[model samples]
Target: MNLLFVADPLSSFSVKKDSTLAMMLEAQAKGYAIWHCHIEDIKSVAGAIYAKSQKIKIDMAGSPWYVSTQTKEMKVAAFDAVIMRKDPPFDMSYVTATWFLSQAKLEGAKIFNDPVALRNHSEKLSLLEFLQYAPPTLISYDLKDIQDFHREHQDIIIKPLDGMGGMGIFRVKSDALNLASIVETLGDSGKRALMAQKFLPEISEGDKRVLVIGGKAVPHGLARIPQGGEVRGNLAAGGKGVACPISEKEAKVAEHIGPLLASRGLHLIGLDFIGGYLTEINVTSPTCFVEITQQTGYDVAKQWLTSLEQYLK
Candidate 1:
């Protein structure tokens, strides 16, 4: 099988923890041909999607992770599967890339996480669909509305619509002197919209990442604990990763959401939780494959590939 990965440049990948790299290595070990392409590499030629793609060889144990063997402009249907592993800020370019991939999807190439679903699902606002499982949340551009939420909740977390890795996330307390400033900055003086959630003190315990693959929950979830004075438990924000057995509640949540999401073309998803409340639904580039595997002895990437093989069959 020939598998194409539409993602960032190979040189930019962090081999130690990148889930896409892990999946690629697993596919290589299984003797599949590996192809690489950047989002910009994709183009529409006479209304058909084509990519300036490269056939690549990888050495995970080596200093340089990948070496391109050859490059060519190929139709998207040339590959058996296309893994859309592009990381997110969910900007205009990302949306345009998805539109390109959607053309490939229509032309009979399998695309992971379904380009159509990715466009429909906003990682932050997607939680609204399951509001019963989430904390009190508000998406607004008005500073007055946000301030009212903060006053009602006493503590809240505010973030921009497209932020990831905890960037642009702020925790505001009722007594915080800069609460109004935070709202202004995140809301961009009422021009840019932001999401605000009632702060769950359970965040102090940990922010759990529950990975669901092929409509089933992985038995273990990675609990990222905030470090020092940081309020964000994102690994990029200096949080410590600890593998925790999935709680019954979390497992139920994953089981309920996983298949539904998979049916929409999101076979792999990362559901974030603080306490028992669902925080965010990450469909674009959900991570923590290595961290959980190292701690819990579960080869998540291998399992994912095994499932993918079954899915393809």
Candidate 2:
């Protein structure tokens, strides 16, 4: 099978922990052709989508990690599968990328976490779909509303709707010295919207990332434990990743949400849970494959590829 990965520049990937690289390695091991392209490399020609891409070989022992063997322009639909592996702050450009990928989808390319679903699913707000499993949350651009939420929750987390790797996340207490300032900053004087969720002290334990592949939950979770008094448990924010078996509650959350999303074309996703409450549904480039596999010996990348095989059959 020929797989096209629409992702960031390959130069930016760290093979040690990059999940996309892990997937590429697995696919390569299976003798599948691997092609790489950035979102900007995508184009639409006379209603057909194409990408200026490279045929690449991944060498783990090398310094740069991947070596490009050849370069060419190919119709996106020519590939058997198009993996949308772009990391997100889901900006307008990302939205545009999905639109182009949607064109490829219409032209017979199997796009994982379907382009339409990616556009429709907001990482933070999608949790509202299963609010019964989430903490008390409020999304607003109004300072008064945000202040009201903070006051009601006593301890709350305020974050931008379009952030990943724990960027732009703030934890504020009802009596915090900068609560109002933070609201003003995140909301940008009522011009920008932000999410506020009642703080789950269980964060001290870890922020569990439960991966849902092919409508089923992976048996283990990557518990990213925050370090040095940090409120963010993202590995990018210096949190430590500890692989642990999924809890019954975490499994329940993924079980309830996974198939629903899968039916909508999201074949792979990472559901973030804090204190067993669904915090986010990461459809765009959900990670932790390498971390989970290395720490627990559960090859999530292999499971994902196997799921994709089943999906294709």
TM-score of each: 0.98, 0.98
Model 1 alpha-carbon miss at residue 170, Å: 0.8
Instruction: TM-score for candidate 1, please give it.
Output: 0.98
lDDT of 2 by residue, 175-211 (tens): 8669878878777777888999999999988999999
In model 1, where do residues sit more than 4 Å from their true spots?
none
> lDDT tens digits, residues 1-313, model 1?
9999998889888788988988998899999999999999999999889999999999866668788899999988778888889998788899999999898888987888799999999998899899989999999988889888888999899999999999999988779669789888777788898999999988888999999999889999999999998899999999999998999999889989999999999989999999989999999999999999989999999988987887788
Residue pairs of candidate 2 with colliding backbone atoms: none
Report, for every candidate in turn, its global Cα lDDT versus the true structure: 0.91, 0.90
RMSD of each: 1.0, 1.0
Candidate 1 lDDT trough over 10 residues, lowest sum: 59-68
Off by over 4 Å in 2: none
